[model samples]
Target: MVARVGLLLRALPLLLWGRLDAQPAERGGQELRKEAEAFLEKYGYLNEQVPKAPTSTRFSDAIRAFQWASHLPVSGVLDRATLRQMTRPRCGVTDTNSYAAWAERISDLFARHRNKMRRKKRFAKQGNKWYKQHLSYRLVNWPERLPEPAVRGAVRAAFQLWSNVSALEFWEAPATGPADIRLTFFQGDHNDGLGNAFDGPGGALAHAFLPRRGEAHFDKDERWSLSRRRGRNLFVVLAHEIGHTLGLTHSPAPRALMAPYYKRLGRDALLSWDDVLAVQSLYGKPLGGSVAVQLPGKLFTDFEAWDSHSPQGRRPETQGPKYCHSSFDAITVGSHFWEVAADGNVSEPRPLQERWVGLPPNIEAAAVSLEDGDFYFFKGGRCWRFRGPKAVWGLPQLCRAGGLPRHPDAALFFSPLRRLILFKGARYYVLARGGLQVEPYYPRSLQDWGGIPEEVSGALPRPDGSIIFFRDDRYWRLDQAKLGATTSGRWATELPWMGCWHANSGSALF
Candidate 1:
C-alpha cells in the first residue's frame, strides 16, 4: 500500500504537466539558459557556479539545498519556475562575526536553488516568483499635516537618529513604492487587536520593530507634552521608541534613551556620545572603533529579568562570595568569571548554594559591608544583618531604614575612599558611622534630575570618585566634587543595560 501511494504521488506531477502542450523543446531550453545566465551575471556568480542542466548531479544537490532554505518542498528536478529564480539578482552582505549574517546567507542560498527548479518547469507565478531580495515594508495612514512645527521637527529628528548610524542604511523610496520600513501613528482609540492601545496613562506610548521590514507604531491618542508636564514627556517617549527601532531593547541605565519610561528632550538635545557609541557598536562604528563590550552570557540572569508574572516557581539562585585567603583573592557578589588579568588575575568562579533560611520572604535588597564582614539583606521594609561564612550566622534585624516608602529593588556600594556606605534605590542615601541619612546630592536642575521616583537596581563607585546608578535600562554617574560644590553633580553619559547589578572589577576562584 505504501509503494502504491508513493507511485501515485510521483505520477501526479506528470499528470499535471501532460495537460500543457509541449512547445519545441529547443525553444524552451534556449530561453531557460539565457535567463539563468542573466541571473548569475547580475548576482555576481559564475555561470558554472549554478548547474545549467537538470539531470546534472551537482544541479540536483544545489537545487535541493536552495529549496530547503526558502522553505519550499525539496524536489531535486530543476523545473522552469526554479530556472527564473536562478536568474534573479542577489544582494547580500556577508559578515563572519554576525549571527544575523549567517542566518541570511543560509536563506539566500536555499532560495536560489529552489528558483532554479521552479524556472525549469515554467511554474513561476507572479506572487510566487523568487525575487532574491530582502523583505520590504512601507508606512501607511501617516498624518497629512502636523498640528505644529515642533511635532514635525521631532519626527524628522527621530528618523535622522537611526539614519545617521554608520552601520545602518536607511532607504527612502517614492511615495507609491514599497519600502523596507514603515512608520505609522494611531490615535488612542485604535487597537491592533492585540490589546496594545495607548490609554490615557501607562499604556504603551509607542513600540518599534526589529531590523528587516519592521514598523514603528505610536499611539497618538495620549495628550503629548514637551517637558515633565503632569509627569509625562512626549519627546522622551519618542526618543526611546526610536532607540527600539534602532535594535536596542530596554537597558538598565536610567539616563539611557532605551530606558522604559517617558522622558523629555530639548530640540538641541540629541544622541549623546554614549548613545552614539552603543548604537554604533550594534550597527558598526561612527568614525570606526572597537565593538561594544560583549558579556560572557547570552542572557542576563540578574534581578531585573525576574518575571513577576510567573507563578511562584523555584526562585532563581545565586552563590555567595568565595575567598582564597592564600592568594588574597576575593570574589564579590554579581561578579562573573572572565579572562585572567596580569597581576590582579582572579581565577575560576565558585557557585553559591541555594537553600532556604528561616528569614523573611520577598527580600528585595542586599548589601555586604567589607569593613565589618557583615552582610545585610533587606525585605519586609527592614534591614537584617547576618554574619559568618556564606552569611550562615544567626540573622538579626538592624535599625529600620525609614526613607523608602515602598519595597525597593536596591543596590549597596561601599565607597572605601570616602569611608561611607551608599544605598541607592528610588533615592540615594549615605550610611556612615553615625546612621543612615538621605544625602543632599541632587542633579543641578532639580526639576529635571531630582529624586528618582522608581527603584534603583544597581550602584557602583567609579575610579574618578563619582557614584554610578543603574535603573531599568539606563545608567547615571554623579560626580562627588560637583555634588559638594553645587546642588547637581556632573552626570556621566548613560551605559547599556547589562544587568540589575554590574561591577568593573573583582572576582573569586573556587
Candidate 2:
C-alpha cells in the first residue's frame, strides 16, 4: 500500500512534468492509480471500500495518512526516502485475513472441544539436564548465499543475550570439529536422519535440537537479515532457537521468545520475563558478572591446529606456556580475555581484573618468564609480575626498570636464548633475565632480524620451534634459528587453523 501510494505520487508528478517520455498519460495514469488502490485495499488501508477509480484528492489523502502513520512527512508526495523505506525486506509473519480468521476458528474449535475433553493436553516441557553452566558453541558452516559478517554478528548478539541472564558462559570453538553446540544453515532436505525438511522461503525459518542434542539449524531459503528490515531478523530467530538448545520448549505466552511464531524484538526486548524465568529455572541465577561481548574487530581462535601440528600435542594442554596458563591459553585483546583450553574449550570473556587481580585493565603486552615461572604484564610504561596466579610484591614498576620501552605492542619470552623480547612500532627490544633490571643497550630495530612486522599485537613460541608474531588479522612465522639473523619470514600458514578463518565472520559465545 505504501509503495503504491508513493509510486502514484511520483508518477503523477512525472506525467504532469512531461518526464515520462512518449507514454500515454491516460493509460499510464489509470494503471498507476489502479495499482495504488489495489495495494491499499490488499493491505487493509481500505476497509469495505471496493477498488474504484480514485480522484487526485482521495489518492493524495490516502498517501498522506500512510506517510503520517509511517513517521514520514505529512506531504502526500512520494519522496525518495519514503519510497526507499517502503521496499526494504520484512519478516515472514503473515497478517492476512485468512490466517487471522483461521487462527480464530482454531481457537474456537479448541475452546468448544475443551468441555468434552477427557484429559487436558499437556504442554511440552524440557528436562533438568541443563548445560555445564559454562558452555561453548561454534558456527560450523555458513549458508551458501548469505552475508557472512552480518550472520556472525547477529549470532553473537543473540547468544550474548542469553548469557546475560544465566550462569551460562558461551565461547566460539572450531567449526571443523565437535563443540557443545554446533550452528549451521541448510537448505531444503538437510539430511539429519529426521523427516523434517526445511520448506523454502516462507515456512520454518529455523529450528534447534534440545539441550544435550547440541545443534542449531537455519533454513537457508529464508532471507535472513540482521536488522528489522524485509528479511527475517537472525538475532531474534536465533535467540528463540537457542532457547530450545538451552532446554526450552514452545512457550504458551505469545510474547515469549520461545513462542511458536517469530516476532521482531528490539535490543531491550530481546528476552522476555518468561524466557528469563524458564532459563533460570534450569541453570540457576546468573553469576552477576559483567557481560563482556566481543564486537566486530577482535578475532576468534582455538588450539585445534596447534594440538594437531606439534610433537608436544597433549603437552601444551597440561603445561603453562609463555602466553597462557598450564591448561588454557588466554587471547587477550584490549582488556577482554577468553581462556581457550588445548582441547578447544573456551571460558566466557571477562575483564582483566576478573582473571588477574591487582593488574590494571587494558594491558599492552604480557609474557610468562620460563626462568622464574612467573608472568610479566606490561601496560603503558609500567610492568607487573605475577608468580603463578598471584601478583608479586612491590610491583607495577616503571618499564625502564626492566629496560623496556613505554607502550610496547607485543612481548614474549625466548627461552632458548634466555631473553625476554618485546616488540613495539618498527623496533624490537631484548632484555636478559635479570632480577632488578634488564641489561642496558637492548632496544633494536626490526631490520636487525630479517624482515619482520614493524609492530605486533602478540607473539608465542610454537611447539614446532617457530615463533609466531601476530599483527592485526594476520600473523608471521619465523624459525627459531632466525631470531637475531636476517631471513625472510613467511605468513602463518595455520591462519585458518588458528581460528582466524573469515575476516569478518565470527561470534564469541560469551
Candidate 3:
C-alpha cells in the first residue's frame, strides 16, 4: 500500500536548482552581480572587465571557477556561500604564480638556508628533533572578512592536522598575552620583527616564522572565506603556513601543501607524504604511534602498512561514482557501473541499462541491503528498488512517502543497524530497514559524527564496520560504535585505496 502511494508521489515533478516553480537562479540584482564580479576579479578568478550588470555567461563562468577552486558545488549563481566567501578577509597571496617559478625560488631559498645552517653547525646528525613537543598559539588580530569564531575554527583545524601526525600538542592562548606562536592579520607594512612586510593583495598569501619564534601573519587586503569550497580556503593556506611554524621548509613536491607556490587545492587539504616525512623528521611520530595512513584502497585491501603512501598511476574517472557492496564492490559514474572483483580489478564501466533494465539514468545515490540483497536508487525525491537484476513492483517511489526527506543529498543502508541513513543539508535521518518508515527519533544533526562536514555527497561502509562520509574531495571516517566520538579522516587521494593520481580525482563523491 505504501509502495503504491509512493509511486504516485514519485510521478510529480522534481524541484531542481533551488525550486521547481522558480525561474533559474540569477544574480540578486545588478549591484550584487557587480560585487560578485569585482570579488573574483581581485583574486584573478575573473579576467575580463567586471560586467556593469552581470547576467552574462562570462560572469557566471568566473563565479563557477571560484566556486570550483574553493570546492563549493559548481553552481554559477551568487549563492550565500559564495557571497560569504567573497567578503572574508584573507591573505593577499596570488594564485597566478607559476609552479615552475615557485619551484625555482624555493630551491634557491633551501640552498641558502642549508649554507647558513652549515656555517652555524646547527645540523644534528640524528636524534629526536623538535625542541619542544607542546606548542601554543594565539591570534592577536582577527581579520574582518570572517567572524572571529570562524577564524578560530579554521586555525584550530589547521593546527590539528599537524598535531594528528606529530607529538606536538597545541593549545590556544589568550589574544593579548605572550605566546610561543603569535598570529595576526595585517595590511601592507605591518612589522613582525623579521624586517619583512606584506606586499598587500596579489603577492604572498601568508607566511610563518620558523619554530621557537612562532609568528604568522596574513595579508588583510584579500577576501577570505571559511567555507571549505567557496572563497579562499583559509584552512588550506593556514595548513601550509603552520608547517613553517613547526620548522618545516617548502617542499618541491607538487602534491605537498608546503610547496612554495599557492595553488587552489580544490577539495584537498590534507598533508602529503613529503609533508609527513619532513614534520616527522623534525618532531618525530605521534606519541601514540606513527600516523595511520589513509588511502581509498587501504580499508578494503592490504596495500601498505605505513603512513604516507598510496597506489600510484592513473585511475578511472570516479567523480560522483555511486558505490555499493553486495558480495563485491560495485561503483557507478554517470550511466556506467563497474564491478570491482575480489581480486581488486575493476570491470569496464558498463551502462546500467545493460545490466538493470528499468534503472534510471544518472543515479544520484545508491545503497545495497545486506539483509535482503536489494539495491535502492535515489534521484531527486524519488527512489527505486531492485532485487538481483530486476526492478521491484511499484517502481519509482517518492522518498517522502517512505518518510525520508525530499531530495536527499546522500543515503546508505546500515546493514548492522537495519536502518537507512538519509543525508540532506546539515542533518541526517535514520529510517527503518525495508522502506523509509521513520525511526522514532531521527533527523539528527551531523554534529553526531565529529569532524564530518555538512553537505555530504555520499557514503561508503568500510569492511571494519565503520562508515566514511564524503563531501567535495575529502572524507571523514567514523566508527559505527562511537558515533558521537571524533573519528579520523584525510583526503581520499592521500590514501592508497582510492588510487587517485591528482587532487581533483577520487572515487568517493556523487
Candidate 4:
C-alpha cells in the first residue's frame, strides 16, 4: 500500500551541530534568508535555491511549511519566531524521512478508529527496516569517562527501552565478531562523510546510519554521561540512535525520545507514546506474553550521584617499592602480579604458572572469594581454584561450563552483592563463590551497574570494602554504597599501595 501523505504536523527541533555553522549575533535580512535557506534545505523542507523567480516562490513556500510544522505563524515570512527556531539543537538526520513517516503515522492514528490492522499494514510498507526480529550489535569502542561495563549497561537499557515495546530482541555481539549493528566513538572526521563528521563537544554530538547500514557514531570530544543531567546524556542519545537503527525517523511529537535535541532523563517513561507507536508500526506488537518495559526517568536519575568521592586515603608505606625514581628501562615485558601488603610492602613478583601447577601464564582476571578465601584465577577459557599455592583437584574447568566468559575484562568478589561478579563487555556474570558456578539468572546485562567500561585489566576489593577497577594507567573506584563509580584517576598515583607515588609529596595533586 502506498501510504498517502497526510497533513503537516508539529516536529520538535532536530540535531544539527550549531557550532560548526554558527551565526553572528546580529543578523540582517540577507543573513536571515541565508540561514533559513540552509535550514530548509538541510531538513528537507525545500529544494536547492537560486536567484530565479520560481526559486523565490518555493523559498517562501518552504518558510511557510517549516513555520507550520514548527507550530508558528505560517505567514510565509522569516519572522523573529521562525528565525529563533532555526537555532535550536536538533538531530542531524534529514527531516525528509521523519515528516513522511509522521504523515503516514498521523493518517494511521485517524484510521485506527475504523481499521486498526490496515494502519499497521500500510505503515509497514513505508521504507527500509530490518527483516530479522533478533538483532546483534557491537560497541567497537567507547568514551573514557565511564568504563565499558557501565556504558554497556546504558546502551543495553536504551535498546531494551525499545524492544520492551516492540517485537524486537537485541544481543551485543562479541568483540572481533560480526554484528548487525556497530556503535563506535570517533572525533572529527573518521571518514563517514564530511557532513556527518562530529563537531566536538556541544555541536553534532552523534549521528547514526539508517536501518540495514546499522552504524552509529559518537563524538569522543563530547562529555557523554549516563543517568546525570550533566554532559550529553549518552543513554538518551543512544536511545535516539537505536530508534533510527530500528528504521525510526526523528519524531515530531514534543515528548518523543526521538526528538533531535538533547533531553535529560526525566522521572517518567523514556519512550513517549509517539515514539512507541512509530516503532510498533514497523515491527508490530511484541511477541509472547511479556508486558512492555517502560523504564522510569527517576531510575536514571538515581544511577548514583556520581559522587565527589575521594579515595580511601592511604599513604605509601616506607618499605613499599622505593623505586619512585626508577628509570623506564627497568620495566620488563612480561606481566607480573605482586602482592601489596596492608602496610604497603610489595612482595616478590610471582608467576601464575609457578604459583599454581595447572593454571597457565598470563591470567586475564582473578578474584579471591571473600567467603571461601579461595583464590580464583582465569586464563583464556580455563579457570583454576587455589588455596595457598595448592591447586584444587578437578578445578581447571572450562569457564563456559560454569557460565563465565572465556576471558572476562575483570572480576571481583563484589562486597555489596557478596557474589563473585565477572565483567566482560556489556554483560556481567555472577558465580557461586564456593562452587564457582554461574548463578541461575547469571551472565546478565551490566546495565544495572550502569557505567563500567570495556577492556579493564583487573579489579581490586579495597580494605574499606570498595572495588577499584584497573585499566591502562587509570582506575575507577566503585562506590559500594551506591553501586556506581564515584572516583577515577591514575591508579599509580591515587592508590599509594600500587607504589608509584612521589616520596616527597604528602598530598594528592588533585
Best by lDDT: 4
lDDT for predicted candidate 3 compared with the true structure:
0.60
Instruction: Let me know the TM-score candidate 4 reaches against the reference structure.
Output: 0.52
TM-score of each: 0.29, 0.35, 0.39, 0.52
Worst 10 residues of 3 by lDDT: 298-307
C-alpha RMSD for every candidate: 24.6, 17.3, 19.0, 19.1
Instruction: Say which prediction, candidate 2 or candidate 3, comes out ahead on TM-score.
Output: 3
Worst 10-residue lDDT window, candidate 1: 321-330
At residue 216, candidate 3 shows an lDDT of 79
lDDT of 2: 0.57
What TM-score quantifies how close candidate 3 is to the native fold?
A: 0.39
Separately for all candidates shown, the number of backbone clashes (residues 3 or more apart, or on different chains) is 35, 6, 18, 17
What's the candidate order when arranged by decreasing TM-score?
Answer: 4, 3, 2, 1
**Ranking of all candidate structures by their lDDT, best first:** 4, 3, 2, 1
- Model 2 worst lDDT window (10 residues): 296-305
Over 4 Å off, model 4: 1-26, 48-53, 71-75, 113-127, 302-510
Per-residue lDDT of model 3, residues 321-417, tens digit only: 2232101122355467776543344566688889878776656667887778888877667888889888885677776876787756677777657
Candidate 3 vs candidate 4: the TM-score winner is 4
lDDT of model 2, residue 53? 43
- Model 3: how far residue 55 lies from native, Å: 50
